[model samples]
Target: MTNIGGAFRRNINRIGADNLSLILALVILVFLITVVSGWAGYDGGDKFFSWQNLMNSVAQAIVIVGLLAIGETVVIVAGGLDISVGSVASIGSVVAASVLVGVGTFGSTLLPTGNVVVAVLAGIIAGMVAGAINGFIVTVLRVNPIIATLGTLAAFAGIAFLLAPDGKPIGVVTQPDFTWLARHRLFTDVGIPDLNGSAWTGIPVLTVIFVIVTIIIHILMAYTDFGRAIYAIGGNEVAARLAGISLTRIRIGMYMISGGVAGLAGVLLTARTTSGNPINGVGLELQAITAVFLGGAATTGGKGTIIGTFLAVILVGVLNNGMNLLGFNTFVQRVALGLLLIGAVAISQWRQVREEKVRARALALQS
Candidate 1:
């Protein structure tokens, strides 16, 4: 019994007590919203609660900021930041689309393995190359992450614009399977009844992709040495460097990861919209920042989680969908979102302070 009790305690320790309250708060909020909305005759079926609407919401949330959050989580945890994620996303899609169109009607038998593979690879390569440039500019020029990424943000955006010379979408990308990835339902084969007399059944394919990608990323960040290094670097760059960690390589890796993921998001967005424009991801950086911050990553660095990000993403989705359903104007919605973000941050800071105080008191008593 003692052994079993100790084992249970150890498991509890691994989970950490800090985030339990956040989870509780999330549950309470969700419950309160559901009950209140139901009482008020909300019928969020068309608003945010429907499978289609929820999937659409999740897709929009993930595709625009998902990659950026994954990348920023690494970058910020590594004690750096990049403002060029949006640009990378824009460039990535443009490159992929350009490659697809350039492949012509013999798309399936192209120089590469297949058109799908080529398109994905094109985006990945464009993003990685752009990331490398950002890293070089940061490490070589010794520029601040903000400034360096800002300059590259403009330059990369320009290059993406150039690649999209016609300023119009290209390719026969409307193929059902390809289009279904971002715009179609997941269980049409399962035969779910459709509301609104519309044929949009079950879950959106984008939501499934987001879930799969998020799970993979969650594992990667939690179970790898590279992931640990990212957190250490962000927590204390000087200490991390003094500990014999490779500051240059890790720094570069963070940016590259950021760029690569942003590129991935671009592809998903393009698939959803059937467009591959240079200006596609405009203001996306802001949304990504919002997601990162909302996900519980400290603006000052050294704290984050995949779960936190998931909750935050869903929170934003809920807020957006709810407000739209409530018929709130754009200005009001923005104001509410801003206030919500600020409040969450303030709560985090307050909790951090309280925990520090508790630790200090315990130490003092022990002494």
Candidate 2:
């Protein structure tokens, strides 16, 4: 019994108290939503729990923001923040659409398939360039990350509108191959039927992409020297410098990764909407930032996990879906998200203070 108790304690410690709390919170929220849904008679007398909703609707809806959150996690872990990702994604959307349509200098030179390839590459490169610019401003120009990204946010949004035809959305509905990323599903025939008797559409490609990206990021952060360096830099810049970590290189790389992921999200946005709207991805940066902090990431940096952020993404998605199902308006949803962000930040600060007090007590005892 003693050995079993010791093992359980060790496992709990390994998982972290905050993460366990987050899990509990998630479970409670689901239960409450389910109960409310039952009482309100939403979804035609069915409760909120359903395979279709989880596998299809919620998963698909969260992909874009989820991708952004993954990138934000890396940046935050490196003691940096990026507020320009939404604008960067918009730029990517317009750039990809323009290339696909052979607008301007693209000149209809490539075949349809070639255009698709080029457009995807162009969008991703545009995002990387934007990220590189942010990094340069922060590292070489010595500007603060927040201020630098905020400047680029407005600038990039302008650039996105300019890149579009007459500052309007460009239609790509004619491109069947390009829209596959948004419309197609894997194993369309395999999933369980919904209450409406319609067979599930299988897993969304966008969701699959999000999952793959998350897994890769988790691996990178959990099992690599580069990831350790990022944490060290965030934890203590002076100590990291003494240990020979290249803060500039790591910071820039992180920004680039963030931008690249945003670009991919933009590509999917274009596919999902069947157009390249210059206004696409507006306000998404806030949600991504919210998920990062809500996932138990330290506001002062040096502590976070991809898994935590992913779960937070699911929580946010479910909350939004439930509100929509309950006929709540966008304004109310926004208010709820704002409150959640405040609560998450407050908890983080409280934890930090408590840890400090515990450390002080330990030092005194040692003395």
- The ten-residue window of minimal lDDT in model 2 covers 104-113
Candidate No. with top TM-score: 2
Residues 192-274 of candidate 2 have per-residue lDDT tens digits of 66754544658889999999999999988889998898899888999999999988898888888889889888888998999
Residue 339 CA displacement from its true place in model 2, Å: 0.7
Q: How well is each residue in 14-79 modelled by candidate 1, as lDDT tens digits?
A: 754444545666666566455667777765534444555655654555556766776767776566
Judged by whole-model lDDT over C-alpha atoms, candidate 2 comes out at 0.85
Evaluate residue 317 in candidate 2 and report its C-alpha lDDT on the 0 to 100 scale: 88
TM-scores for every predicted model? 0.83, 0.93
**Model 1, residue pairs in steric clash:** 77-234, 78-234, 79-234
> Which residue segments of model 1 deviate by more than 4 Å?
1-22, 28-47, 59-61, 103-114, 171-177, 190-200, 355-367
- Ten-residue stretch with the least lDDT total in model 1: 104-113
